[model samples]
Target chain A: MQILEFLNTHMDMVYIVILSVLLGVEVISNVPSVLHTPLMSGANAIHGVVIIGAIIIMGKADPSNILTMALGFLAVILGTLNVVGGFVVTDRMLEMFNKKKPGKSKE
Target chain B: MGEYLLEISYLIASVLYILGLKMLSGPKTARKGNLYAAFGMALAILATIFLYVDEEGNKLQNHIWIFGGIAVGSVVGWLAAVRVKMTAMPQMVSIFNGMGGACAALIGLIEFPHYFGHGGSILILLTIFAGLVIGSVSFSGSVVAFAKLNGNMNKDIRLPFYNIINTLFIIAIFAITALLLVGTLTDPMYVYLLALISLAYGVLFVIPIGGADMPVVISLLNSFTGMAAAFGGFLYGNMAMLTGGILVGSAGTILTVVMCNAMNRSLTNVIFGAFGTGGAAVGPGGSGVEKSYKEIGVSDTAVLLNYSQSVVIVPGYGLAVAQAQHVIHELEELLEERGVSVKYAIHPVAGRMPGHMNVLLAESNVEYDKLVEMEDINPEFETTDVVLVVGANDVVNPAAKNDPASPIYGMPILEVEKAKNIIINKRSMNVGYAGIDNELFYHEKNSMLFGDAKSVLVSLVAELKTL
Candidate 1:
């Protein structure tokens, strides 16, 4: 009964999940094969939004409990790495393409 | 008021992410697209830190822990991404994706005790467990993939009856998770035990896969991390995490499917078939015919290149192994100077990951227009004079087309055999990642050029200068 209640109350969130999936598929289908690596990496970076969850948990964590605090702290660190590293690497990859025009003209 | 502001911030961030992904479809706008997504991330983080308020109207207070973690992680992540070689991009992505998975798993672990200690709803419990198990698997699986790509684990190790055992192990994991859900298991240790089992399963799942199947495996794990993050979103009912996570999950899934179609293998076959096992069983075509190949030296290769009207180069992972990208670019330019039109024919599953060959070629300053995908270049091979197969074997393997019994038969290849002169450069007569012999090597028009890719290209460049 509680599970049903929760689902009924959060139907809006469920709709968001479905629409997001459809939109993701539609947008990603247009990417040319040449951009596959950067696109995959960019998507990888986007999922790093779980850092939001990590931050929220850390804030509510009981400071008296070392296990909870430690887990929360570790989550925040790993989440930051995922977000920052994923985006930077993807940008660096695309940067190669950005420079190609100038480099070609110089030749 | 702060709650509404935070919600609005999430909506804007989600829109920017969608726009960022849309712009990624074009090379001209992709760099700015990544910046847009980064800007969105900053907006969301700032909103969370400053605007977030619980029902008790209390703001987040652990400033030192929050900022300190962000500071350390950013410095390390930024340095690693900037300092890594272009050749190492696949493993870098694997490791960073693993970090995301690890973060999700930690959230599950941190939250599980609270729910269990208070007898929370089964729905909440289910989401937490899903995040924990899936996140742990992605984290450990990606670490293994990273190790394999980084050359730390060169050999694919398959235990006896691996598929059956792996199946049983996964079933047991889910069964125990179900038991916990139904209140049959009350111990908190079960949660941690489940995470451990999932981690072990991840390792077992990926350890048997050969190098050639790494693209599918990495894409699958990337999606797994996304699904785990989405579960985190469901747990918190946060729109930003939900949208971002679902987007990644779908993107990774589509990529995995595309790669599987390229290799003509299903996702299940890639995971459980322990592919390349057929390499040892059959020679080319399984006809037991005597196969012989002619060897071409540097000077003759140069002569062939110098006389050709148009040349199409097919590159593979061996090019990366030898760090021959720069030398090959020089060769391309040298050929162009002598009135030979040069283009690179890139197979879809050419290297360790999707579009890996493009990244390697681009890093060496190969013009963007010169890199042609398989669908575009397959027809041109027929009229081309010289087809240079450099550090590549299987992608050009004619067996994929004509040999039905071959493991890679249905896989679309470069069709280099159609060219007037087919010259393949390899270190020796070794089977490629598919573990099968390439029938193209022995074709009438093909000549084997054996040497390290870098030195061989260097010699070819030098020989061209002499001509």
Candidate 2:
């Protein structure tokens, strides 16, 4: 009974999320030509946000319980990894800009 | 009160993402764009923690495991990144993207069960499904892409039943997905089956793509991973999802288009062309062909340029690897001073990535109007007096003309072969990333000046001074 009541109240939020995700998928599929590569490279950088969010969520969880603590600890580790890894990857990608143009002489 | 604060932070992160994307659209501002994206990610993370609420409407307890996990993952990630070589960077990117998909899928798996059966919301189920489909595809597809990039996968593997098997696997995946959704199966056993099927489909998705198309495949898979992460975010009601999803979705779509343009194929053609089937065939070797020209020093090059009606400059990966755009710009300035009409011919997949050549050229302040795409410039090559090819290979190779057995036969080339006189600046006769020998080297109109791309160009610039 409790579960049924909860479902009825949250139905609107559920429908909204689904509709938004579907629309998001459609928009994602039809990206314009000029912005493709930059868009992908940029989005790869944003993936880092997941790591930080996961860390904070775990950090505030109950530490007294071993299972919860373990989950939180794992989250923090993965989160940090994501953050650091993401930055390193982004930096490396940016370094491609530093390459010399072919068929051009160095000063 | 705290939720409102989190919402504000989300708003800030969203703005950063948009700013980052906007800045990335042009070459001069790309560095600033990268930094903006990093800042947005940080904001999203901070906001997520602030808004997290427990079952009793109180703050969650301290989490030690999460911290420990973060510490370990950071160290490992740092070491892996620091030690990776530049030559292996593309493969490393594939591996890292695959890990992201795996992580998202795992999160959905662990979280969904807990939320489900106890009247778990549809949002949770949908998120799980999204994670499962996208994550699984990314994880498997990336592995195959990595294999191709590393030469572990065969460049020309065409079996009779390969396509049939791939079709069957895809069908099975959809069947299982339908069963899971319809509540026909109640056990976790089906979950594992679904994963296996999806994994198989991922591998099949990339196995038939030729080496020439690997870059496009990689970019497309990257978009898939981002979409998966965004879906996961939606399930959790996390602001990060809304921001990250929008950014990734937009970016992925854009990359797919760019990759398609590079090969002169549509996105659908790339995905469905499977088995090394669609692109141009290779041309006959120009071996033993008569060469009419002698190796000329930079002074000779400069003298010839003085009376030339028009000059076309071709840029390739060698430029990007050596970081030589500025020097090229200086050379262009010198030529333009003598009233030489110089235009740059940019092949779609000229460098390691799409727009790589454009980005490098734009960095050196090369005028946007001076850069011409493959289709727009091929016709002009016939009337071109001097076609200077700098560190480029396959895209300009004439083998696409007569060699049906060659890997690049049908693909449109820059028609540098059609020019009156061709000056190729290269270090050696070595093959390109596609591992095919160029027939353009032995053509009668072609002259090979072997040396480092940057050094040769510099020498040519110095020689121009005497003219």
The top-ranked prediction according to DockQ is 1
Tally clashes: model 2.
39
lDDT of model 1 at residue B183? Answer: 91
Candidate 1 lDDT, tens digit per residue, B243-339? Answer: 8888889878987887788788888878877566744544644456677899999999999899999999999989988999999999999889888
Tens digits of lDDT, candidate 2, B1-467? 87777778777776776667666655546557767877877666655555656446765445445445756877887787667655455566666666666665555555555654656555566567767777788879988887877668856455567768878887887777666665776676787777777887888888777645777887788778777767766666665665566456556666666566656567776666552343333223335554444465666677777679899999987776665677888888889988999999988777766565765676577776678888889999999999888888878866666676766666777989888999887777766656666767767788777778788778778878777
Native-to-model Cα distance after best TM-score fit, residue B357 in candidate 2, in Å: 3.3
lDDT over C-alpha atoms for residue B1 of model 2 = 82
* lDDT scores of the candidates, listed in order: 0.87, 0.67
Candidate achieving the largest lDDT: 1
Q: What DockQ results do all the predictions give, each relative to the true complex?
A: 0.77, 0.29
Error of 1 at B186 (Å): 0.4
